[model samples]
Target: MNERFNKLRQYNTSGLGCWVSLIIFALIVGKIGLGGVVSGFLILIALFFLVPVIGFWGFQWWLKQKITQAQCPVCEYEFTGLKNTEFNCPSCGESLRVEGDRFTRMTPPGTIDVDAVEVSVQRIEEEN
Candidate 1:
């Protein structure tokens, strides 16, 4: 039941805590000189906006690194795609499926037709 609360307990800092801390710090520094207040304000803005923006782009770069490159099995045309993706080969127009670092022909969807003999069911009276 405690799992509901302690789900790894991630730091959910959305920069507001820094803003509050800087406001208090800035007010103290503001007593010293106007320059200190201005510098604190600049630092607060940089931390609030620039930090998250840089982190977002950095995460995107990390994820893009995982999207591997593969080649079309039929035409040998190389391309990049996410794992287990199926798409048409851009160079040859052949349907291709990707898995891990390699590519293969996409198997056609739907069940195969099977020829079978039809059987008739008859009801018989059971003797006691």
Candidate 2:
């Protein structure tokens, strides 16, 4: 996943979707109890579109903010905002795009690099 998306994941990890869904279900049940089938159905129909659309858009905005705040390690160029596609650094002419579990431009030459150190820590912890 991209570092930008990772940031969004941080924001949304509290399970906002699940909470909203539960609330909607509760509201639907309440409407059914008070106003009968017709009223319940009407509210459900409105919420069906409103809840998911707003939730998705909010998540998108959060993700976009994360993308914009990221700086290219090679060039130190700041992204504008809401990048719908991959971006390259403007200063050093290096790719700022993240790939898989690794940061492309940020990786170093030696085996004692950050990634290697993380792997070493995991390996040692697992052994213990």
| CA RMSD, predictions in order | 19.4, 26.4
* Off by more than 4 A, model 2: 1-35, 61-68, 80-91, 95-104, 111-128
lDDT of candidate 1 over 46-117, digit per residue (tens): 899999999999999987866868777767788887666777888999877777678777666683635578
What shift in Å separates residue 66 of candidate 2 from its native position after superposition?
A: 4.8
Model 2 C-alpha lDDT per residue in residues 55-120, reported as the tens digit of each score: 999999888555545666654566553344455566677654555322346334563423333334
Candidate 1 scores a C-alpha RMSD against the true structure in Å of: 19.4
Measured with C-alpha atoms, the lDDT of residue 14 in candidate 2 is 79
For all candidates in order, the CA lDDT equals 0.79, 0.63
**How many clashing residue pairs appear in each of the predictions shown?**
0, 0
